[model samples]
Target: MTTTTSSLLNIRPNFFYDKVINWFPGHMAKGLRIISEKMSSIDVIVEARDARIPISSINKKFEEVANVKERIIVYNKCDLAEESSQDIITKAFEKYRNQKVLFTNANMDRNIKTIINIAANKARENPQKYPFVTVMVVGMPNVGKSSIINSMRRLGVHRGKAARTGANPGITRAVSNTTIKVLENPTVYLIDTPGVMIPHIPDPVCSLKVALTGGIMDHLSDEEVIADYLLWRLNNFSNFGYVEKFKLPGPTDDVNVLLPAVSKRIGALHKQGCLRLSGT
Candidate 1:
C-alpha cells in the first residue's frame, strides 16, 4: 500500500467481458534465463509460494535453477493456510535442502521478520562476492513475491515499497531491485524477479489448480473448466456447501446444473461468460 520505489509499467488487456477467451500468455522464458544468469551473484534464493498449495504452487524447475545458491523457502500468505498443514509442509521440504522454512503473511506483516533473519543469516554465512547480502525472490505469478518485498521493507527497512503488488496476475513484468537495510546488522538487498510459471505444465489438474488459485491469468482459462475442476475438487473433499449456497435440491457434480441456479438466484441474467450453463 506504500509508494513504490520504481513505477512498474504493468500493461493489462482492457477488453469487454463479452464471451472472449484465450490461452495463458506472457511466458517469461527470459525471466528464468535472467534468474539463472543472476544466480551466480545471489547469496540466497528465496522461493516465495502460496501457502494454500505449498507443493503445487512452486515452479517445477526451481530446484535446478537454484541448485547453486543457498535456498530458503518462504511460504507467503500464511494467514490463509492452516498452521498444522504449514508445519507438515515445512518438515517435508526439509529433506530436499537443509534450509530453514518460514511461513509469512506479507499482507498482515506477520512472521516476515523471521524470513528476513533466516535469509540474511544464510547469505552472511555463505559469503558471496557482493558486499551486502544479495537475495533473489522467485515464484509464479500472484504468489506474493512483491508483497513479501514490501513486508520486508516495512519492518526491516521501514521505507518505500520496492516491488509492485496487485490482486491480478502480471503485476510484475521485469526484474526489479530495491535495497532494504535490516536494523539489526546485515544490510540485505532484495531483488524481485517477475513471476514465472513453468514453460510446460504437463498435468491438467495441476494447471487447473494453478489457474483457479490465481497463479495464472484468468483470461487464459476456460471459466467452465475452472469451475468444473473446482466442483470436482469440492466433491472429492466431500464438501457440499455449494448445494445449500446455490439453493440446489441436492448435491450434483455437474457445474451446469449448479452454475445457472446460483447465477439466476443472484439476479445475474447474463449467465454466459465466466460460467457455462449448458453441459456442452
Candidate 2:
C-alpha cells in the first residue's frame, strides 16, 4: 500500500524491474494476420477494452490492421469500474482513437442495446446495398469479445450464450468461421475475433494492468508480482476490502508477507517453510 501519488506514478522499481513482458504466442501472430487480411469485410470494428485500465488495454495490432475501418470502442466490464472513471474512460478513449465510445456490461443485459444501435448507425453511414450488417467484435483476450456477442443475442432475441465465456485470457484463439446473428430489427451479424495482444508489452505499467485484468496468461506472470500490483492499486485508492475479505492484520505492501498469510488462510500449503507458489 503506497501512501502518496508519486509512488503510484512510479511503478518501475529501482532495480529488478523488467521493462517488457512477452505475452504474445504464435497463435496471436496468426490471429493478427488473419484480422489484418480480413479487415476489408468488416463494416464496424467493435474494440472491447477493459474499463479499469483503459489506456493500457488497447491492442496495437488491432490499430495497425483495422485503423481504416469504422471503429466503435466498447468499454466492457463497466460494472467493475466506478461511474466517474467510466465517464473519463469513455472520453479519453474517444479522443485517443477518434472513435465513438460506449460503456457496456456484457455479463448482464444492461447497455447491450447500444452496441447494435451504434453498429446499425455506422452501417447506415455507408449506405451499402448489402442485405445484412456485419460487425466484428475485437479486443485483448478475455475482454468480453465472446461475452459481448452472447449478451447481444440474449438482449436482442432471447438467445443464450452464443459464444463461450471464461476467466482466463486468449480463450478465443481465432476468428469464428461464421457470423452470429445478434439483432433482427435491422438484421445485424457479429464476428467474434480472437482477442489479440501486441507482440511485446514494453511498458511495465501497461503489462501489469493487462495481467491484473486477465488479458495475459497467468503462467507467463509471477502471481506474487501480480498480487503485489493489485495490492498497490487497492491501497492507492484506499480500498481495504482485502482486510475483511482475507482477514489480514490491516493492510500490507509486501506480497511476501501477504501471500503466506493468504495461502495459509486458503489451505494452499500444509507444510510450508516459505511459501513458493511459482513451483520453481
Candidate 3:
C-alpha cells in the first residue's frame, strides 16, 4: 500500500531505528550444541527456508554443521513469495546434485505430505550406505518448522492447523526429533529444530524492514521510500486501491522527498508551524 510520509510517521515511530532487532539467545546456542553432538547420526539434512527471502532466512552456521551430509533445501511459504523468485531459488540450488530442493506451502496439508514423500524418496536412494536415514529440519523463526512436523505426524489424517503460527518471529524454541518407518525399507528419523535467526550482516535499517515487513525487496532509505517503492511496484497489480484510500500523494523518484512527505502526513510539526522531520 502507498503510504504518505506523514501517515507513515504517525503509524510508526523511530524512522531511523532498526526494526525488530534480533540477537542469538542462550537457548539457540544450546540447540546448536545439541545438533552438533548428534551430527554424526544424521543421514540427511532438511533445511527449511522462507521462499520470500531464501538468502536472508538461512543460518550461516548450518553449513559448518551440515558438512559432508546429504542436504535437502525445502522452500516453504511458496504462496507468499513471487513465482519468479521461487524459480530462481530452485534453479540456483539445482547445481548441487546431492542437495534436493522442493517448493511447498506448509499451510496446505497436502503439500506437506508431498514434501515428506519427496524427502523419503531422496533418503532411500542411498539406502545401502546408511541403513537408517536421519533427517534434521532447520529453518529461520516462524518458517513453519513445527507445523511441518505436526502435519507429518498426522499423516494427512488431521487437516486443522495445529502448529503455533504467527507473524512475530522466533516462536519455536526447542528441538523435537521423531522416527518414522516408510514401507519397512528405510527407517527415517526427522529432527525438528527451533527457529534460528541469523543476525543481519548488512545495513541495519534494511534488516529491520525485513523483520517488520517479512520480505526484503530493493533497499529504501526511510519509511516513505519504502512505501513509495512498494506503491510503484504494486501499481501494475490489481491491488493499487491502497494508494487512493490513504490519499497519499504520488511519490517522486528522489529519496530526499520521502522524509518530509512522511513527516507532514504524520503531523510531525513543531510550534513554529514547521515539520519536525528529525529528533523525535
Query: What tens-digit string does per-residue lDDT give for candidate 3 at 1-280?
Result: 5544443322222344444345667767877877788888877777777777667677778888887777777788788878888667766766655567777776665366665565567557766775666677777676667666666655633334335656655565667554533223445556777776564545564455455354332232345555544543444343545445445465333344544545556778676756674455
lDDT of 1 at 225: 76
For each candidate, what is the lDDT?
A: 0.73, 0.78, 0.61
For candidate 3, report its TM-score. 0.65
**After superposition, which runs of candidate 3 have C-alpha atoms over 4 Å from their true positions?**
1-20, 95-98, 122-132, 156-163, 177-187, 213-241, 244-280
lDDT of 1 at 262: 74
* Candidate with better TM-score, 1 vs 3: 1
lDDT of model 3, residue 65? 86
For residues 1-280, what per-residue lDDT tens digits would candidate 2 score against the true structure? 3244343344434324565666878888888788877887888888988887777888777778778987888888988988799767656756876668888888886688988887666556554654567888889888888888999888877888888889998778888879898877677898887888878787886787888888888888776777887877776676767766677766666677677778777877657555645554
Global local distance difference test of model 2 = 0.78
Residue 2 of model 3, lDDT score? 50
All candidates' TM-scores? 0.78, 0.87, 0.65
Kindly report which residue pairs in candidate 2 clash with one another: none
By lDDT rank, best first, the candidates go: 2, 1, 3
Residue 247 deviation, candidate 2, in Å?
2.0
